[model samples]
Target: MAAREYGQYCGLTQALELVGERWALLIVRDLLVGPRRYGELAAGLPRIPTNILAARLKELQAAGIIRRAPRSRIVIYELTPYGHELEPVVLALGAWGFKAMGDPRDEQIITPDSMTMALRTAFRPEVAVTLPATAYGARFGPAELVVRVDGSTLDVTRGDGPVDVAFAAGPDIRRIISGELAPDRAIATGVVEVLRGRGELLDRFASTFHLAA
Candidate 1:
């Protein structure tokens, strides 16, 4: 089936033509953190049907928003240079929509990419500036991500690496980030676990990043 186009010359309309389809922007969101193979993308977006995922990938590729490349000798889908330029647009949209979020229910799923991207969305350079250089790790369910802070630079990357502090968190990470639960209390309540390093690292993390209320 042909993609539905807006048939307009407006920049916003044109952009939507390329990415406004269902699951299209979410695919972009998944890749924003980094490249991913087909399986990884599928796993991250469990609700998307397999055929729809494949079609979206093709659409994104045809629009030059994403491209296929080799990572570790395996083909992966990554954003093109033009596609990477959508970072600000995506972040802005996320920030704007954040206020609407309340809480998740028992059936709702929060993907790893969503959490990691939220880390980027909530990064506070002002807070990072006061901190000593360190890397913090959070393992929530099967997903592992690391946050590296140096001076005012904070980077969150997928997968576990050498980190100064590691936290094994439950779905309560959102609660922790939202300040509804203090890290220590979450740990004490068995909702979060300090897998490695000082338990205080959680406090430092809470202070360093914010959800913008």
Candidate 2:
């Protein structure tokens, strides 16, 4: 085989070389939530130019990180099982970014997607709480999510329903987990609300899983 022009490197370096560009990680982050059409991805990432987005998607697909699926005469981008595995890595990076750069209140705006990622990242397998089957709702930006917490994991779907716990946060989930806001006070000020279910369970859930120093 002929020598490669990009130079030879180990797996990690090669992986980074494919995705090290700015906005590339964010592209992966958007796909983490769910499959999206080209327009949807482009809409979500306003900072990314159309041609660049197209090229990056092509690169990722070529590298086997994402796959293209045809739906309704349009192509949608979805992460492969291998690509799905990167969710934790992306979440960890997000958490690290939050910690290294102190919270800026003015800049703290939680979105539904962010909330879902935060929930997954903050989840503690050790803290097992049996959630009621009751439905719950939370609103972030133009999106409303129905959250169902079962055992150690949580399931969140789009739309509103009668949720056991209805909570809203003005700050990013990382800041909330980092103790910037007293969880109790959040409830008091209506920043967080537990509409149903055992309120004590919510408190215990917070204590057991919140990301502490």
Candidate 3:
């Protein structure tokens, strides 16, 4: 429950009361990726204060959005079945916000979970289904991911692997994804670097994962 009530009878109001506190939705975002131990959550959300993390966890559990469970002999937090329903809402929010994300600030950094959600948000399933399967090792700043696309399914995981193409880029890669810059031009401008394998595959990657700016 929220610390304070809006004293209104509305679904949105009730939803806000449940998870409108600062950092609450972000906590839900990380949990949407997978169950995370306390330390793992804290590491992913580097800016969250320890006391605040604890408080949010308690509030979420009390609201039945998340639950505590023992995993591998340690306690981890995971979203409940009802909480899993927020995935579409989060993805829509990500796509909506992408339009306003022009450039990242110096202090802004990407995390694996965030990158995962971003890719999921922008993935074009119909286009992907018409293309050949491909795997890419993508490095966005410090976040590394092995992205695989088979038909309409997209899977993103951490670490490197045998990929058709490997590329590194910073936030500027958004231009390529948004089709604002051609993959060839992005490479020429140093906005994207083809680290290994066939660089042409990057065009395929751009088509597979895209969101108009």
Candidate number achieving the greatest lDDT relative to the actual structure:
3
Provide the global lDDT of candidate 2 against the true structure. Answer: 0.67
Better of 1 and 2 by lDDT: 1
**Model 2 over residues 56-108: C-alpha lDDT tens digits?**
88888887889999989888999999888888888888766656756546644
Question: For this target, which candidate reaches the highest TM-score against the unseen true structure?
Answer: 3
Per-model root-mean-square deviation over C-alphas? 2.3, 3.9, 1.0
- The per-model lDDT (C-alpha) reads 0.84, 0.67, 0.92
With candidate 2 superimposed using the best TM-score fit, by how many Å does residue 208's alpha carbon deviate from the native? Answer: 6.0
The runs of at least 3 residues in candidate 1 whose Cα sits more than 4 Å from the true structure, single-residue gaps closed, are 70-73
Question: Which pairs of residues collide in model 2?
Answer: 135-162, 135-163, 136-163
Over 48-158, each residue of candidate 3 has an lDDT whose tens digit, in order, gives 999999999999999999999987789999999999998998899888999999878899888988888889999999999999999999999889999999999999889
**Model 3 residue 136 CA deviation in Å:** 0.6
Q: Scored by Cα lDDT, where does model 3 land?
A: 0.92
Estimate the TM-score of every prediction: 0.87, 0.79, 0.97
Instruction: Pick the winner on lDDT between candidates 2 and 3.
Output: 3
Ranking by TM-score: 3, 1, 2
